[model samples]
Structures are given as structure tokens and as C-alpha cells.
Target chain A: MSTSQGLRAWLLTEEPTSRRQARMAAWYKGWLTLRSNTLAMLGLMVLVVLLLAAIFAPLLATHDPFAQDLGQRLLAPGEGGHLLGTDSLGRDIYSRLLYGARISIYIVALVVMVAPVVGLIVGTVAGYAGGWIDVLLMRMTDIFLAFPRLILALAFVAALGAGIENAVLAISLTAWPPYARIARAETLTIRNSDYIHAIRLQGAGPLRIVTQHIWPLCISSLVIRVTLDMAGIILTAAGLGFLGLGAQPPSPEWGAMISEGRKYILDSWWVATIPGIAIFSISLAFNLLGDGLRDVLDPKEGQS
Target chain B: MSAIDIRNLTVWFGHGADRADAVRDVSFEVADGESFGLVGESGSGKSTILRAIAGLVPTWSGQMTVAGETLGPKRSKSFYRKVQMVFQDPYASLHPRHTVDRVLSEAMQLHGVRDIDTRIGRLLDDVGLGPGFRFRYPHQLSGGQRQRVAIARALACDPAIVLLDEPTSALDVSVQAEILNLLTDLRQEHKLTYVMVSHDLGVVGHLCERIGVMQEGRFVEVLSVEAMRRQQAEAPYTRHLLESSINSIR
Candidate 1:
């Protein structure tokens, strides 16, 4: 009884100074909570470094990413003016690393941005509507999942032909199924929740229940999934580039640089090594960041 | 006139091999400004009756009319506007991600309410939550506070009939009393009609003017609090329930 009185007193206490003050408090709390995760902070630092490198590639690189000097071809690190040596086409490995960051960063940003919106819409509709709609939509998602991811992406790229746009499309198509599956599961869990039922009872429509109530609650998991998928997307783009299906020759994509320099592995190890390291570092960073985010955003973990 | 009227309602779930009827041959009426209680154990279709009325459980065939309009295959906005529901778990009934403001505002927005902020403010105040709580998320509030917010959200559209499915069952005993008091106060203040489904006869006795005892998807007896206290149960099933509860408590 005393506990209940104390709770009531707390609830009825004087209001916050203002809405802005309340918002600032919430923001500060979130930031403080997020900052506690060391691994997430490290991942964030790596992401920032990659993003900075991608944004200022022109300023950071002395030699042009695309320019080739045939005489300098197959040069090892510390040879002539090439810092990280030269690819098979004689493009500077340092400059290509900088430029390749642009492709990786762009693909990650675009895929994460596009896939979630589509998946959230489709999954929310299917899960919230239930019955025949749910059955039809889930079956469609299953069909997309039936094919192995890389093969399906390869098939899509094959159909759309090679280019950045086709690559983005392939990744987008392959990526949304996971989001759809996750969002569907989330919606299924939340749809039966009391708040959702309460919202429905208030005469709020199906769309409102999904967009306002369901989506916001599920967004944290969706965000973590998107971040994890970033690593896979970068890897897939590189794989395609290796197969000569992404970023045509001399374009200086990381995988293309590796493919072009693979023959010189014994002598000019730096040619493929630098770009390979960049890919590994960036993908690893995103995975770690995603894991950290999952820990932080989870309510059970957040409270502790 | 009846605020909510239902006749011969039946609800079924699953299909073919898994199919089974969950609610069968149920009928009741709640008069305007009256509180009617439906008491039943788990799986007795009490909650399903509420869901059927709310249009969440659409697999049911029933004659359900709220505010004199006949309910149909698709739920109309008007039907929702008049009849709303408060669910079992306060913890789950309010979306954890939404602020109390957004939770209330979204409902008003869907109903195309004008002057949303004022309406929301008034609702928050009506539910006894201070203005500060309006901006706080569900996690920030206590269970009772959250339930209050849930009640406020329900009252946003000035719904005439509110279907309450075990609203206080999730709270502590003392907290349950407080919520029950709040609910009773709100019902009286709004002149609202209530169709509360609960297993607690004491709660029903405290709040409801009429009580219906359900078993196996059917009402075994519908009686007033006076009838219940007098131990004047008409049906064998209601007598068994009353006897069992009495025996357990003793």
C-alpha cells in the first residue's frame, strides 16, 4: 500500500520544465547508455574512419585512383612513388583503397536504407492483416528464400546485366526477405500484444496500428539486422567484382583490384593485400557494431 | 436503448483438420451508461466475445450491434468510434516505444480529430496522469500509470462503450483496487457503458451492475450483484463455480 502511494506521488509530481527539456533528457540518457558498450564504440570509430576515407578519397590520395602507369605495373610496396604498390593495371593501391571505400560505403547505405522500408511495409501488412493475406505474402517470401542467396543475386545480376545499379538491385532483392521474415515475426508477436489490441479497440485502423504502434517497437531489431546485412552486402559486391560482374575493369573497385593483382601474389603482395585488408576491416567493423547495437537496444539488456 | 447488443454469436478458429469453435450461442446486451460483467475462466470465450466485437477475431458469425448499428463483415470507422476496448495486460496494452502523447494522439488522428494536442492533454489529465507523463514512454511509467495511460487512450475518442478484458488481472492486489477505482470513476464520469470480462467475481461485484457467468463458450447464468451475494445462483455450472471459488478461498 505504501509502495502504491509512493508510486502515485511520483507519477503526479511536477511536470518537466518543458518538452524540449524532456526530449534532451531522453536523448542524453540514450547516449549515456549507448556509450557504455566498448565494442560498439570501437566499431563506430572504424565506420567513421571508412566513411571519412570514402568522402575525401580525392584529397587523401596523391596518385589518381584511375590513372595507370604501365612502367610502374607490378611494383612492390616502397618501389618508386607507389606507397602500397600498383595493381596489374598499374593503378596505385593506396588510391584504389580510398576509391573502393566509396563503393562499399554507398552500397551499404543504399541497401540498408531501401531494404528496411520495403520489408517493413510488406511484413507489417502481412502480419497485421493475417488470414489469407499473411498466407500469400509469407509464401511469396518463402519462394524468394528457396534459392540460395548468392545464386539468386548472381541470377538477378545476370538478368539485369552488370553495373552498380544492378548490383544494388540484386542485393536489395536478396536482403528484403530477411527483413520481411524478421518484421513478420515481430509483427506477429506485437499484434497480439495488449497495446495493439487496445489501439484497435480505439478505432485506429490497421495501417495506424502497424505504422504507429508495431513498427516503432520493432525498429531496434530491424536496425541491428540492417547493420549486420551491411557486411554481407559489401562482401557480395566484392564477390561480384571478383567475378567481373561489378564495377568494370580499371574502375578501381576493391575486388577488381584483387582479381587484377592475383597473378602477382608472389612478388607484388601489397597490390591485393591493401584492398583485401580494407574489405576485411570494414565488414568486421559493421558486424561488431551490429552486435553491440543489439545488446544496447534490447530492453532486457538496457535495464541491466 | 442498448449501448451494445449481441445475439447468437459464434466464433471458430483454425481450418479443416485444426478447426474448432471457440465461442458458441452467446448473447447479451449492455444498456447505455450501465456496466455489465462477463465472468469466465480461461478458454471460456469471454475474451473472444470482446475480440469479435472489436473485429480482431473476424472468423466469427454473430449478430453484434453497437449503438444500434448492425455489425457487418468489415468493421466500419463509426463502429470503432463508439466501442473501444481495454485489454488484459497493462504492460502489453501500451506500446513500449510510444510516448503517452503519441499513444493518445494516434487514435485521435485516425478518427480525424481536430485540435489534437488539447484533446491529448485533456485525456492525459482525465486519466489522472500529470502533464509531464505525456512525453514519457511506456517504460518510464509504473504498471498502474501505464494502465491509466491505456485507459486514457481508450477514452480519446469519447467511446460510449468500452470492452474491458481482464483490465486489472495483471496488477498487484492493491494496485488492482486502485485501477478498479479509476475505471469505475472514469465510467461514471463519462457516463460510459462497460462490458468487462473477468474471472474475479469480487471485482465484478464491485463495478458491474449486471454479471454474466460463462462456461464452455456459453453463459451459464446472468445475474446482478445482489443475486450473486445472496448465493441465488440459478444454473448448476454457476453454483459449481461459486462453490469452487468459495472452497479455494476458505
Candidate 2:
């Protein structure tokens, strides 16, 4: 308790002794704002629980996720040793759900990593290096924006063949255009700012200006945007999985499990209903977190 | 030798259909250690000339020689090393995210200044700020404090010429006098040359030895502060400007 109190006092100090303290103070201030928001805190807690479930899936599962028994097919919830009952193939529903969390987290991780970086580079370059470069990159982004996200992803997945990696790749391609647009808009404004001109007068080159100066300003808004878009990315991944273009059969992916349970949906609702609830909760959690993050991270929303 | 020499400098904006010359065929020179001021009304292109000299505005045709080196389509790294600029708005000049130390250190490091930790402390002290101000972000500082940090950043490279674009215009009037006095002391201590652009003749008169009165993209006359004070100006526009400045002060 004393250590935490000391840390809080340090973070709230008006005079920081080092750069690290200042950075931590800023982050702590943001955390404080986020904590004040009850709904956002709830969403954060849900995501934390999801993450823990994904990490400890092996220890938490009652049975092997893939092990099958035709005799015990379609058991209801709280029956026998199974916690959430069994799926169509008698694979434990509770265990499959736990394993499925890992795949969902992996997809989110990959898409988050791949999409935003590609968008940031392309957007900052296009925005900072204007004229023909701007025209060229923006037109490319326009073309990407022209296509419906799912249809485009479907095309990429169909051509690349069905797999989780291909689904992530396809989603990343579709996801980047909006980030590029946001970054470009941000860059256009930031490039003309007095701070930028001040840096340029310091003998800093265009490369330095775009990478060091402009990117830092652009990243906060981009981060807010990325969080807001997380729901869509997850939904797109699930859509691909539902169509059998993601995390092939026997992988226990939530969407693919739902696809398998579609036949049993009329009688045994738990087979499909449970996984659908999982997807809904996760997506809703991201959306709530994104909204809260915008309140904290968006400079426009900040006090002058 | 002149610290800055400009020959037939013409700066414009937009393409053929919408071509508007912001500064046309303007020329001037400031000798070493001289403080020159440009004063005019809004949209009179006083700041445009300074932007052109700094190579911030690329759409200009001129011969700008700074610190004995001729400026071309691009300003060399040494040009930046020799010349630095303090912008008009302190609120907009410093990066919102960067701390005062980061702002000062980045400037010195860009020019390869060694022993940055000590230099930053000294720079802050030189600008009348304590070492405690080092780790605070721009938002944490007041307008006067931010302007002081901006001044410190400009002095980081020890440039021979410092361009002031209405440096204290955005500041409170009380803070303005403190900053102007600070600039005066910094100039004398460093033996620096200044090319300042401002609409407030009182400010220009306070810090500058010679004031150039401009009108509609043209220099009406370049008169010394003595000539301006004595009301012995050359152009009718100068007399009019002088009358207005005195009127505003009254």
C-alpha cells in the first residue's frame, strides 16, 4: 500500500526529475480518466478475463477440445462431467470455447499488428510527401475503399485458399484503407503546423519530420481509430470463419463451430448459441473500450 | 559583411489562374549584429518574407544569402545550423507531446551538439527557466513559459541569426514586455542578428534599431528607429503608420 501511494505521489508530482517519470505520469493520468468511466472499465475487465481464459485454456479445459464421442453427442448444459455440454461431434463445448478464445485473440493480435503499421507508413508518406505521391497513394486507397470489406476479404480468402492466416491477411488488406485515410488527413494538418516548421528549421530532413514529428501526433488519433475498428475486424474474421474460409474444421473456432451447429440449432440451441454469445461479448467489449479510449486519447477532446 | 542579404525576392501562392504575389521584388540587407524589424498590417506579406528566407515557403524566386552562404532551392543543413526561427504562436510552436527537455535536446542533437544534459540545463537557465521546467509538457506550461522554451530551442544550436515572427503577439501584454526584454538581453549576450516581423510598432521600436514599413507586398520605406521617433520619415505611408501606432498606444 505504501509503495503504491509513493508511486501515485510520484506520478502526480508537478516536477518530474526524469523523462521516464514524465511519460509515466502522462500514462497514469490517462488511466485515471479511463477508470472514472464505469462502462469502459467493465469492458476492460471483460477483455482481461478473455485474455486470461485464452492463456490458461490448457489448464482450464475439462477434456481435450478435439476428442470426439458419438455416443455422447448433443448433451445439454450441466449434464455429466461436461460444464457447458457437448457440441455436434461430442467434443466438449466448454473446452472448445476455451480453446476458441486463443484463436480469436490470435486473429485480433495479427490484424492489429499488420493493418495499422501498413496504414501508418503509407498514410504518413502520402500525406507528408504531397503532390504526385499523395495523388498516387490516395487513389490506391480509394480503390481499396471502393470494394465492400467482406466481399474483398472473401475474394482474397477464396484465392489464397481457406485458412486462419489467409483470413487475417485478407482482413489486414481491407482494414488498412481507413487508417491510411485517417492518417493522411492528420498528416495534412500536422505538416503545416508551426511545430513542424520549427523542426524543419533545425536542419531536420523530410524523413525525420514525417517519422519522428508527424507520426507521434498522428498515432494518438490512429490508436483511437484502431480501437474503434477492432469490433469490425473481429466480426469480419468471424464472418470468414462462418463461411468456412477461416480456421478450418476441427480447429474449434467460434464461428466455424456455429456453422457446424447450424443444423442442430432448431433442437439443441446451446451448440451454436453459446459460441455466438462469446463473439458478441468480445466485440461489444472492444467497442466499449474504443469509445472510452477516444474520450481519453483524442486531443480534440482534451482540455486546452 | 551583412549577416543576411536578399536580392529581388519574390514569393507567391497558387497556380496561374489564382496567382497572387504575397511579396514582390523586395530586397533588404541586415549587417552583422543588427536587429532589423518588419512592420505592416495584416496580409501585408511581412511574415511571408521571413518564411521565404527560412525556406519554409518553396514557391519563391530570390537570392537569399545567410551567414555568407547562398540559399538555393533547398537550405543546406549548415544553413539551419547557422539560422534558427522562433514562431509567432507559442501554443502552436512546441510539440504538444514533447517535454521541455525533449524540445531543447532534439534541437541540439539535430545539430550534433555534445554534452546535451548540461546544455539543456544551461539553455533553460539562459531563458530564465529552472531545471524543474525540463520534464513538463507544453500543455503544463503557461503561454509565457512555452514561449521561453521556444526561445531556448532556437538558441540550442547557437545560430548567428534568429528570426522572430511576432514572437510575443499571442502572449499577454504584461508577459510581452518580459519576453521583449529577454530577447534584448539574449541579443546583446550572443551578439546575434535579428530579423523580426510584427504589426506592433511599439514592440518593433522596442527591440529593433531599424524598422521597415511595408504596404501591400511592397516596402514603403526603411527608416531607422531614430528617424521614426523624430517623425522625420521619408514616405507618406510611414507617417500614416507612425500616426496609427501612436494613436493605438494613446
Candidate 3:
């Protein structure tokens, strides 16, 4: 290489020593923690596979999930060109299971992303401001928390009419209260700290303090809660889909597939059983990931 | 013009019956480039006076000003740009998560001050820290180092007056001397005014030209450091406190 080219390459590769050190430390810590947690690794592996399968369902699926095959209805498992058998409607059970993962991803993403952002903003404002704002916001969160999750979701879906969007909305509405409570508690502790007082004295406004200091501290706990909530969110989505409150027929949803197969659960078995296992495994993986994250993020929280 | 002027400053907490005065009917003035200290024991309202000036103590009835401008109920950014405070506990005053760079940069950023890199480097150098310490987190710093960072942050806004609330009480005697010396040098170098609140006669003695001895939310005596050092306090309480403080050092 020319000297000028070599100099350019060297400049491009160079990083500040502190930044490089911090990144390496983080990367090594993550590697060490992941190596230690066998169950989490397995769970992560399962999630990766499910994610890829969902993404590549069009390519991975042996047959179309929606195509009716009445001529070959009730094909048993291990039958020629049919794997995990065909359903009562002669839809490919394996293909539906693969496609069902897409629905689960949507619900999980909404619950984990939307709920925390809204909750963090609301709770931090209430906690930092305190007094009447605290009372008003906390009371609203408490009222939402008083009802059981599924019942509130059911009420919301009932009121809004059935659809994937409405079910997500219902879940998101109910899910935020727990996060609000968590973020509020975290913000209260942070608001009273001496540094916060110092910054207030220096004329740092409420907006800067909340977004920079309060939000970052509260996020670790919020993330842990979100990870743990994923299982419930998936189940809630599945329940909504089963009750015809989420993605309706012609779309391959795990819960809807299970609901449709319930009549022939004993006759064909693969129809409902495969989708049931899919739900169970994904829920189990999310729980594992949540547990692992808590330990990795804060050792004390993990211990408690 | 006076750097800080407070007349009939009174502060209270809670409603009737539960209501208690923290600082009662206090008045003082520290002139431009002058260092005035309020010395008192715990619960003597000196800290409250300082907090009130910083706008931290919300319930107050007072007329206060900085650099000849009367302070309004709502403190403006312009007002903040004229006054800043250095807190007591260095460890707690510097944010645990923020780096020294962030801590100093924020003060400048708030006032829409540009040339952040040059300013940060200058402030760090003023605090006796080099450029390498900028990105290091507060946890990575020593107690004295953290206080220097806090001092740098306070100075970043180019405030005319600094309120020091027992700035050295949280440090060791040896480290305290270093911080005091740094404060003295910085005050001279920048021509900054100060209103420091402390219980230690020796501490305030190092910085103040005039020291107010306070007790139970009232000023027992407002005398020069030279008078305090010369055992010339007219009030019996001031004499007793000074005598005891002098005896303790031996």
C-alpha cells in the first residue's frame, strides 16, 4: 500500500483509548456471562431460530399455510411430502407454526417498546415533580393496576372491537401501569440524590435532568420487567387471537390455529399440539432471557 | 455593586402548627469580588440562607439580588449565569454516571455557549486535571478530584458569584488545604465573589474577609476574620464558639 493510503487506514482504525477499553470490557463481560448461563444460551438459541423461521417462513414452509387441500385432508405425520401432518382444513401445521412466530414478535415488540417509553415519560414527570402531579398520575396507574391483566385486556378489546391492532392497544394500555410504578419509584430515589440537587442549583432544567439522569437509571429495571413480561404478552396475544379479537382467519396465527384445531385435537393431534408447544417454548425462552438479563444487569437485583 | 444582597430573608417549611422557620429575618451583603462567610453550628440557619440564595429553598420571603439586578420569584437563565453553587459532599455532588466532560459540558450547553471542546479543556485545566480525565466517570475519580470536577462545572457558566456550602468539610485536612488553596487561586485568577457557609472557624477564616457568627436562625455577630482571629468578637456566644474552635485545633 502507498504511504498516504497506509496513513489513512491507520487513522480509520484508531479509536480513543478510553472508548476502546470500555467497549472491550463490555464485550468480554457479555461473553463471560453468556458462557456461564447454559439455560439462557439455549433460550437465546431457540429465540434466534424462531425469529429466523418467522422471517423466512415464506422460504422455509413446505406448503402454503392457507391453501385448502380437501383431496388430501387429515394427512398424518410422516406422510409423503407432508411433515407434522395436515390440519382439519388440510392446512400445513408446520407452515402455520412457522408463520405464527410473526404474530408473537409483533405483540412482544409493542409491549416491550411502547409501554416503557410512555411509562418512563409519565412516571418520571410525576416522580420528579411530586406533589399533585405525583398523586394524580400514581392514582391513575393504581386504578389500572387494580384489575387483572387479562380481564382489563378483554374489556379493552371488547370496547374497541376485534383486530390485531386493538389487541396490542389493549395490552399496551394495561402493561404501562407496572412500568409507571417502577419508573416512579426509581425516579423518586434519583431525584433526591445530591447530584440532582447540585444540577438543579446550576439551573439544569427538569427536561434535561429527567431524560439524561432519571431515565437511564430506571431503564435497567424497566428492561428486566419487560423481558419477564414477554411470556404474559405472548399468552395474552394468543388468547386474543383464540377469541377472534386478534388476527382473524386466513392469517396464520398460533392461537387461531389452535382454536380451529380444538375440535380435531384428538383426531389429528398435530393441529393443536404443535402450536401449543410453540407457544410454550417461546414463553419459556423469554423467561430464561429475562432471568439472565437481571443477573447480568445488576447482580444485586439478581440475588434478591 | 454587591454580588449578593438579601434583605429580610425568611424561610419556612410546612403549614400552620407544623410550620417552622428555617431562616428568620436575615439580611446581609457581600460586595463584588469580596468573600463573605456565614459560620454557625448545625440547625443555625446558615445553610438555609445559602440554599435560599441558590433558589433551592422554595418557601421564602425576601428581596435578593446579584450584580445590582433584583431577583424575581422565578429565576431566569440569565440569573443562573450570574450565580452558581459548589456543594458540600464532593462524592455526591458529581453525578455517579456522568463523566467529567459531561458534568462540565452541561453547564455550558444550558446557556447555549459554543466552543465546548476548548471550554471543557480549559475548565479541566483550571481544576488541575488534564484532558485525559475528561471522559472518566465520577466513580473512577478520588474524592478531591470529584470536588475539582464539581468546581469546574460551577465555573463553566462564568458566574460572577459562587455559593460555597461547607466545600471542604467533606474532605480530609490535607486534601481540604489543597481545595482551599485551589479555591483561593481561582477566585483571584477569575476575580469571582463568594458567599460561603460553614461551621468551622478555621475553614471560613481561610476564605472570608468578613464572617457572620449565627445561632438559632439569627446572626449573633457579623465581624471581620481579623476580629475573629484577634479574639475581638463582641457577642459572648461568638467569643465562646471561637475559643472552643481555637482550643480544638491544639
Candidate 4:
């Protein structure tokens, strides 16, 4: 929050007693910041609305997204029961967009949850382990990083089946290297600190020191990086879906919805434009949310 | 059994010609409850000897006996609690993230000592700090106050022996005497054994009953506090040290 210049160090200590209270204070501070940031608040509100729309899709959609009326095909806006109009087969565009949120939300959930954990483990271990282990692990990370991200994801998805899970797995494969590098650098900084040595002398084993001392200190950076990476992950997932390598058709995935509407772009613009807008808003929301989180998570960076 | 006994202890660092012996073939014994001071100039290996005993230095070959028990490469938790260390820089020594309360209580908790709050409060009082300083972080305290907290931490385990690594060197000169005085009072009150390292001969003279003048990884001579204070050091190196030490004072 604006009231504090920086975080106190003791909140990061291994003590279990003060931790919950301090973390609650930190979150309260972060919420205060979130409230002050108008754009982030707007982004949060948009995200919440999208989520609610997705959950209530069954109730909100007047017609099934898949059920098509060939007779009323390509109906214009404000015509019949179709409020925003219909697609080539006369399917409701609004219904499809709401359902598309589920696919986007699922892919993002999977990628963000899995990628950073993979990276944090690999990086911190390699950094803390040092010597040949560090050399071997980091070089492996470098090898993965040498390839272009999208190309690597495409290759992995191609090798696996062309499905949403495959795309998520592929995205994860390309996503973890940078996180590993971040985690490794953070671990190196923490490993040499005098506090680590002090803990070691206090009869704390390596595991104790890493989990209690190193992980907590490194988590703030990892969280900021991971949150910021969400937009890119979503874009990549959409790219896969557009290429027919993600969620199959009839599932109402945003990218697939766009791809389906591509041929009718000249005659009916709303079909593709509506889904495209959905993707754009979600990505913007993630970026805005990320910027807000970075402020609260690392207040020192915000100040300087 | 002596508080500490080392037989031909040798600690080295690096490899080949780059290899340097920090404490080489050095043998010494500190009696129970005796305040032993290792007085030497910088890079003279006094601190290295302290580190070797503290188990901070990984590679060392020798027989080390503490309170009748033989020590191995890895000292046990019980052994760690039995012998604690106070590092040179008070600012550098304590964990900045941990409050004085946690710093004092963590070791006791590890050793399964109950009554943590009372012990912590008493430890604060023992170091000339108050209960108000308990939750304060290291940076929140002044140099002297932090050093007091460090001393309190070292004494928290009811340790039989304490290692002092230039404990007052990092403090302001005005605060140095107060810390030294606190340390002296704590040692006497607890009847604790001390193996303190200091480059300043006078500081050691005031704190230690017997002082060892270490040079080039070995003790040139060990003299009584009375002999050192009376300027009756025997070895030529000891006399040379005394002269420079006195000259610095002048």
C-alpha cells in the first residue's frame, strides 16, 4: 500500500507464528493498492464478469451455441431472438463467446499453475546445488531455450495429439526455462546470504534452509514473473487453437470460433470480430492485473 | 575434560600452489570456564581457528575434544547448542529477517527447551537489553544494541562454551567498551568458557585470563593476562606485538 515504503524482513522469516499475520497484512496492503489502481480494478471487474458469464452460460444463452438454425443463417444484429446477431449457421455469437471463456480460463489455469512450479524447482535446485549439478541443469535449460518458443510449442503439440491438453502441455514445455533462470538467479543470491549460514549453524539441514529461507525470499519475484507471463501463455494457447491444434470445433474455444468465422469475414464481420474482442480484453486484463500485482508484490521496485 | 582440546589441527583452503593453510598443525587446549583469547593481526588465522572449532570450516584434519566427547566432521545439534558463536560484524552476524525473539528462541526450540518466552526475556536481560527489544529486527537496533542481541543469542542455549569472533570490532569505538563489558559480565555470571578472537591485544587482555599470540597460523606464544597486562610477554613476536599494540594506543 501507499502507506508503506517497503516490506519488513521478518515477515519473510521461517517463524510460523508471525507469518500468517504478516501475510494477511501484506495482502491487505496489496488489496488497498489494487483498489487505488483504477485500470487494474477495471481489469479485475472485467475478469470477474467474464468468469460469471462463463459460469452462467447455460442460463444466459437463449439458444445452444452448437444448435444452428440454417433457415435464419447470418441474421443481422437486433433481429429475432439473436441480440448481437448470429454466425454462418445462425448460432448465437454471444453464447459462443461466453463459452469460449471457459476454454481460455482453463488453459491459463493449467499453464500458470504448472509452469512456474516446474521452473522454481529446477532453478532453485540447480542454483543451490551448484558445481556439476548446476552446470548440467542450467545447460539443459539453455538447450530448451535455444529454440523459438512458438515453434517449440507447435512441434510438441504436433508430436502429441491436436487437443487442448496437448497445447497446454506444449505451452508448458516452452514456458518453464525463463522461470528456471529467474529461480536459479534468485536462489544464488539467497544461498550465499549470512542468514543461510546462520541457519545452517543453528542445526538446520539443507532442506530446512531452502524451504524456509530461500523459497520465501525468491517467491515474490517468481509470482510477479508468473503473473506477467499469463498473457503470453493465453496468446500462445489461442494461436494453437486457431491452428486446429487446441480444443476441437463445437467446443466454442475463442480461437476456433475465430477460425470458423474467417471464411464469412467479408459478408458477416461480427462473428470473428466478437471473439477477437473477447481475446483482446482478457489479455489486456491479465497485463493490467500483472502490473498491479508487481506494485504490491515488490513495493521496493515500485518506489525506485 | 577441557572446554576445548585440539591435537594437531590443520585447516587449508584452495588447491595446489593456490592452497593456503588457515590453521596449520596448531595444538591448544582451553580449560573449562577459562576465557581464552586468540590475539593476532589480520590474515594471521585466528578467526580460522575459531571457525574450525565452530564447524564452519568443512575440511580440517585433527582430533578435537569438547567436554570429553570426541568431535567428527559434522557436529551434532546437541554439540552445536553446547558451543555457540558470536561473529565479528554484529550487523553481518544476526539474521536481518529474524527478530531478536526468534533469534534467541529458535535454538532453544530446536534443543526442545520449553518456557521460550521467559527464557527469551531473561536472555534479553542477560545481554543488558530489555523485553521491548524482543520483536525488533536487527536493522531496527543500533550497533551496540545489535551486538547485545548477538551476545544474548549466543548465551540462550546455556552453552558451555562461546566463540567470539572480534565481537566488538564492527561497533563504534564508544559502543565497544559497553559490549565488551556486557560480554565479560555474561561470561562471569554464567561461568561460561570463552575462546574469543580479537586483533586488539588490550581488548583481549581485559576479557581473557590467558592470551595466545597467533602468527602465520600458529601460536607464537601463550601468556597469562597478568603477564600480558604487566608487559612481561616472553617471545620476541609477543614483545613486537606488545610494542605495536602499545604504540597504537599512544
Error of 4 at A184 (Å): 2.4
Candidate number that wins on DockQ, 1 or 3: 1
Tell me the TM-score of each prediction against the true structure: 0.90, 0.98, 0.88, 0.83
- Chain A accuracy as TM-score for every candidate: 0.90, 0.97, 0.88, 0.88
**What does chain B score (TM) in every candidate?**
0.96, 0.99, 0.98, 0.96
Candidate 2 lDDT by residue in tens digits, B1-250? 9999999989999989899999988999999999999999989999999999899989999788889999888999989988999999998998888889888899999999999999999999999999999999998899999999999999999999999999999999999999999999999999999999999989999999998889999999999999989999989988998898889888
Q: List the residue pairs that clash in candidate 4.
A: none
DockQ, in order, for the candidates? 0.53, 0.75, 0.32, 0.28
Please, what are the lDDT tens digits per residue for candidate 4 over residues B5-103? 989999999879999998888888999999999998899999999888888888889899986678898889888778888888777767645667677
A220-293 per-residue lDDT for model 2 (tens digits): 88888887788888888888888998999899899999999999999999999999999999888988998888
* Best prediction by DockQ: 2
lDDT of 1 by residue, A17-96 (tens): 34555555555566566688888888889999989998999999979888878888878876888888887777788888
Off by over 4 Å in 2: A301-304
Off by over 4 Å in 3: A1-42, A70-83, A146-160, A266-269, A295-304
Candidate 4 chain B has its poorest 10 consecutive residues by lDDT at: B92-101
Q: Pick the candidate with the highest lDDT.
A: 2
Clashing pairs in 3: none
Ranking by lDDT: 2, 3, 1, 4
